[model samples]
Target: MDLNTTKSLVTSKTFWGAAVAVAASVAGLAGFTVSAADQITLVDQIDRLIAVAGAGYAIYGRVVANRKIG
Candidate 1:
């Protein structure tokens, strides 16, 4: 799949998987071990947080716009 054509980064499984891997590696470097299941949970939470932030930004943009939606 071409990442360039993807509408949103949060919708990509590969992106989330990589994020989990990076998180695990960072935690390991900090002397904290994160289990596989915990890593999976972290991916889900991060995905949700990003999605929510995007939605919130969209709403804020609309509210602050000078013109009404058609």
Candidate 2:
């Protein structure tokens, strides 16, 4: 595979791992706190995470499109 494809794969994997970790941490915290206020904050955090992931995917697509594969 070309450099861009390789980089994209690695980046995507890392992003997914990080997302999972964040989700797990949030779940654990919610289990302990069990508060409505905390739940709202968690929802906001989830929205931010979705935006970040979307941006990452967009960047990956741009990089892959610009790369020339043989």
Each model's number of backbone clashes? 0, 0
Model 2, 1-70: lDDT tens per residue?
A: 5655544433454555556567657877878443555555655666677679989988898787966666
RMSD of 1: 2.8
- By how many angstroms RMSD does model 2 differ from the true structure? 9.2
Q: List the residue pairs that clash in candidate 1.
A: none
For all predictions, the C-alpha RMSD in Å is 2.8, 9.2
lDDT to native, each model: 0.85, 0.63
Off by over 4 Å in 2: 1-33, 66-70
